[model samples]
Target: MNKDNENLVKSYRLLTVWLLSLFILAGIFSVLLIRLDLNLSSKVTTLFWLCFVSFYFISLLLMIYKTERVYYINYITHKEAQQATKEERRAFAYKHLIVFCIATFIFVIYSIVSLIFQYPAAVDFAVFIVIIIVSALRTVPFKLKE
Candidate 1:
């Protein structure tokens, strides 16, 4: 396969591993929190969530930056996007779809688990909403100039 295809595959693999690790980490943390019965004071819980959210967003940004750098065509202008080959466009769409689906699935699972555990106002619900909104916005195709 050509370099583009190779890079695409590599990116997918990297994303898979990164997401899986995130899922495992979330699971472990959830289990621990449940077992601990969240006995900590509200201040400590808020602090912990603040740290977790900060770390999560930072890591997510870094992962996206790294993945885009590794893949060809990290950014395409409107003209360039229009000129891109059918295969290139398809590959781009597929990549976005895969990411959206996987992320949505993971967050949905987390949210459900948290709800089941009776954490109605859990951060996972907020994360689930944010993921859906962002993914949907990102997946929307740009309008082509007539």
Candidate 2:
């Protein structure tokens, strides 16, 4: 198999892993809270969500760095990438970054609103589901550099 194709698959695989991990993390948090019979204040729940989102963003940054190095900057600048155009590679990066930013921004907004309003206990789980769905739906085709 071609190296570029392999790298593209790896990126998508990592993305799926990231989304699933976040979803599971949120689910477990909810289950544990209930099972432990711990009463959490609204402020505490908000704080928990804020911390979770911070960790998610950090992990996502790491994944983006790894995939960007493999596909956009390092791979495209290599000898085997002679057929790849720099402009196109950069455009791919720019577009995906924008999508990531916008999706995360909207999610954060919804989370804040829900938390402040003291929504149902399912809010966190719902947020996780939305995030996973959004990310999965946004997965781009694994285009390889020719």
Candidate 3:
């Protein structure tokens, strides 16, 4: 196969690995949270939420990194990318960054609101937001770069 093809395969593999790793991490966290709810005292539930929030952010960061990698890979594989104007690349970057920021802000806001209301669903929602923001942001950047 050609270099571009090789790169494409590598990119796909990398994306797959990142996705699988994320799935495993989420699964482990879910199991642990369930166990915590069942075995621990009620007070520990708050701790679980906190843990969830932290994990959420960590996942987000990882996703962003992955997105950047994917975009970089695309740029490398696309020969015409060199011919593209610099402003075009910057525009793409800006758009993706804005999307990432908006998504992140939404989830962060939700988490804050939930914390204030002391709502049970807040924890899960916050965690969900984090995961979504992470995935969306990551994918958007990579795709935009193309």
Candidate 4:
């Protein structure tokens, strides 16, 4: 098979696996929400919703990162991976940074609301850290071996 075709197959596999994982996560959270009556208060509800939204967004970002990596690798295999023009790569990196910033901003708003509602900082930070790590990883450039 051609490199492009192989890359397409890999992307499909990743998407399928990630989508399944997300569905399972949603199911678990839904059960928790129902069993514990987690949305009884404004604070608890805000925190819950924040967590739900953050997880979905981060999952999407990770999926994009994975897809981009596949594209990069496939381009290299096909000898189509030109040395990225400085401005082009910089702009791409900047765009990812902007996305991270937007996600962090939303998290901050949720954290403030959560704190006001007596939610724990530890819980907030734990979720925030995951976002930070994923965003940070996405910004790094990967070199390919010949």
Which is the better candidate, 3 or 4, if ranked by lDDT?
4
Residues 1-146, candidate 2, lDDT per residue (tens digit)? Answer: 33443334323466678789999999998999889987988656764776577558646755554455324322234333333444444445555555556666666676677677867656656775667567646745524343
Instruction: Give the count of colliding residue pairs in each prediction.
Output: 0, 0, 0, 0
Q: CA lDDT of each candidate?
A: 0.53, 0.58, 0.51, 0.56
> Which residue ranges in model 1 land beyond 4 Å of their true spot?
1-9, 39-58, 69-131, 138-146
Candidate 4 per-residue lDDT, tens place, 1-146, comes to 33333333323466577678878987887788789974576555656666666667556555544454333322233232223333333345345646676777768786777677776756676667776677657655534322
Please provide, for model 3 over 50-126, each residue's C-alpha lDDT reduced to its tens digit, 9 standing for 90 to 100.
54554554454455343433244334444443333444444554555455555656655665666676667655555
lDDT of the structure predicted as candidate 2: 0.58
Each model's TM-score?
0.37, 0.47, 0.45, 0.45
Better of 2 and 4 by TM-score: 2
Model 3 whole-model lDDT (C-alpha atoms) = 0.51
Judged by lDDT, which candidate is best? 2
> Residue 15 CA error for candidate 1 (Å)?
0.7
* TM-score leader: 2
How many steric overlaps does candidate 4 have?
0
Clashes in model 4: which pairs?
none
Rank list by TM-score: 2, 4, 3, 1
TM-score of 3: 0.45
After superposing candidate 3 on the true structure, give the runs of residues whose Cα lies further than 4 Å from its correct spot.
1-10, 38-94, 118-146
